[model samples]
Target: MNSESAILFTQCLQNDFTSLLDKYDPLPNSLHIGYAEANRLLGEMVEDGPVFSLMDWAYEKDPKQLKLIHIRDWHDPKSKSQEDHLLQFGEHCLMDTKGAEFVFQSWIEENPNRAEIVNASGLNDFVDTNLESILKPYKGKSIRVGITGVWTEAKVTFLCYDLKTRYPEFEIAVCSALTASSSLSMHFIALDQLKQILGVNVFSSIGAFTEFLTGDQPNLKKRISTNARIASDKLNLDPKYPITDLDKQILLYLFRDCKEVECKTLDGGFSGNVVLKTKSIDHLGHLQVPCVVKIGNRDLIAKERTSFERIQEVLGNNAPSIVDFCELGDRGAIKYRYAAMLDGNVKTFQKLYGTMLDGSGLDRVIDTVFGEQLGRLFEAASTEKLNLLEYYDFQHKYAKSVRNRVETILGSPQNESTIEIFPGHIVQNPCLFYETDLLDLKEYNAISHNTSYVHGDLNGANIIIDAQDNVWMIDFFHTHRGHIIRDLLKLENDILYIFCKIETESEWNDAIVLTDFLHNQEDLGIPLSFDPPREITNEKLKKAYRVHRKTQIVLS
Candidate 1:
């Protein structure tokens, strides 16, 4: 690596801590220190999700720009720190064992020439290792050195202090989110000391560290435009969504002086709004905050703005605060700066379904979601009525997509005349419904219900849950008059099809029957019963249904 290049020296990402995170066996204090963190340290490396893996991201961005150095705790039989360490932290990281190996040792194995591996038995990485020599090349060259790992109080502290004292010329910084400790108190105290006494820079995230490394004077306009182009493909983005050059300029003026601005698309696409979650330093406060920008056509933005205002007025903190809105002739944007997000994130309702079900306050959870907040939110929005036929226009539009997907999975006849989904069941020609004859019955016309100013499209994907269990809903473009039970129906869909795990065809069938029976009473306004068909025996669906059924009954 050159003098101008940065070095990412990750420490103690060993199986001893990372793997023990999901086990029933007891762990040592050394491992517990990092495990007790609110956000698990180094978890991005192991987790499979939309998370940005710092190492992998760097590798993908440009492997040669950032050099890698790893520190692993290896305690051999004749190790130097064995006498003192044995009694203190107990047996761990024994040499030649998997516990002593780096959790991502394959990284070193794959890039043997680019990656450096240093073994240490003590808290300080420099204590009996060649980390100093490995870093000697970058000394006094104005290169940024980032340190991230476990046991932030001890191991992370010792390294930061020693690295600065030895080579004060090299800028040393720690990515706080990447580093963790088993003891929350000690970890924070150590970070405070590291910054105050040692003059070490503490970055809240990798984006900030990357910003410092690049030394960009930062044009917020350029960052937004650049990232917009990087994420230009419309696959995940809202269809036909465009952040026009004028829109980019507006975003620049909107998020003025924001530094380290990193932009990426979120998971869902609904309401003709393409959402981008971006992390940036607040110009006024100079603190990292993640803001979401929703870009859509002008008509959708205008409607959403009005809907957001109404929901915020009625629900108060239950709704996310709208940062600003930009009107760009045919297209516009809604930027939301969430105030409560310390780390600028909350788990999606889909991600935390298990947490909500397994929570201690079942009554509070049900009441808060169904009775108190969202129930009131549904009341506050609008009141429009449409019979099933009119609603079919929207439903049928969605069914076309589902039909195409099913055809892709199970090839149909060339004419699509008779598509058999099961042994005796078929989605005949046009409407793909098992009961295709029901369309001519004219019974759905008699069943009419007021689609109150409800979140027209409600789903677990757009619902947000924070650490405090407070709910936040997004994607307000569809926040107009809709079905009275639209929100509840969406929640049920998540509990059954989205979150519940049904392995066998029988289980899925049972889930379908259960959901259909329960949801069939939406127009009748009838009280629900918890009983299921005697033949139904899917324990996963049954368990999830029990939670949904109780909430549904109470809300209904």
Candidate 2:
């Protein structure tokens, strides 16, 4: 292997061993190995060979000096087989002092070069404390120390007390020794005592410890930062919008405007209503205020708040729209903005299979909206058409540059395939399953045709209907040049999920009819001949529903 590859492998092994030692206890007469599989594999490699054959081979050749021989709990049965025979012979010989001395001499004579001959009873003393000390600097950093010995109640109490007092910040974990015919009652009692003494908050599972040390823990600070970024990105608004001077100015103007209005306070005086009589349109949050703000002028919907319009011109249209921000008398404060339709109306699917929408009419409306978007996309792609080879070169160049960011947001690519499309398909039959065939289409387009700008998140929630019943889109932060089928697959998947929840055969039939109309939209330009229709089977739907139910249970 190349040096780079070898170094990577060594790092992985080090991480694995370091992780194991952190969570488990290495006790006397008990095995201390990184993983059970490694120990088992090693034993199998040297089962019929000379003593320490595998160890000698690995140590003699490897430059990292990874010469440690570890016996794990699972291999104790095999290790005990040899130790038991020796003990039986020694016990018999011990009946006579001269015989016992002879047995010992013969045993030492056979293995003169051996570092130590330890039995189950004496294994604790054989523990290499110096080896543990070598790992001390790594403590609370990445490596977890596992100390296993024949544990007593008193020993457990003292150990927990000493460790908590000595290393209060360090993540200390413990696991009981698993040996032949071992009873864990004492271990359980010791664990309970440790928890009571050390405080239960510090206690965590091995997996939790690993995640915490790796910086994967969902701390409040990390969560808030992540949420802020996600919200800004989803809205296609500037990241600094909420904290910008423009936003502050808009808030101050809104507060001033409200002060001029005849405000009405509701019961308990917690929330009040304001009626601002102004010729200028009130732009509140992202929505045109006339819709959400009752008693506002309907004709003034196009008007913008004075301060907001000035700031919008300066900061550009991408800044988040502010509504009202004011400090109430004696009360803390209040801020209101246009609540996203998705935030207020979008219901999370309780079951993977459930009637998501009431009827086929909804599906048709969705199909039409997406079809129009696809038409615009095709026009854009036509304007940028190039030769097949050049297109492929450009597609790959672009995708490769942004591949890391894409993977971070949408998850890693599962597989890549290439599609062979005829030239006629570009203008005459451009429709294809975009979401499911994105990677394939990208590769094919690079080798065959030009690409188009596609909305990456084309699911139903991104499609919104206003109070006026006009359909609008919200999230388009992931728009990129790709095939049209990506949008279709997203739409189909959404509809499929909704249809799968139909309770009756008639409902299923109607769903299929609606899906067929969507599948055959001329504006969409999808191929008529494609995958065969399958029954919307309920068994899979029930299973999905059950899983979703379980997830809700856990989340709640």
Largest lDDT belongs to which candidate? 1
Q: What C-alpha lDDT does candidate 2 achieve relative to the native structure?
A: 0.31
Which regions of candidate 1 deviate over 4 angstroms?
1-251, 257-280, 284-291, 296-299, 327-331, 354-366, 378-385, 392-420, 424-448, 512-534
Q: How well does candidate 2 score on lDDT at residue 453? A: 56
What would the per-residue lDDT of candidate 1 be over residues 400-419, giving only the tens digit for each residue?
56667666777763245666
Displacement of residue 474 (Cα, Å) in model 2 is: 0.6
Worst 10 residues of 2 by lDDT: 4-13
lDDT per residue, candidate 2, 63-114, as tens digits? 2322122211111223454466445423312222332221113323554543
lDDT of each: 0.61, 0.31
- Relative to the unseen true structure, what is the C-alpha lDDT of residue 73 in candidate 2, on a scale of 0 to 100? 14
Q: CA lDDT of 122 in candidate 2?
A: 25
- Candidate number achieving the greatest TM-score relative to the actual structure: 1
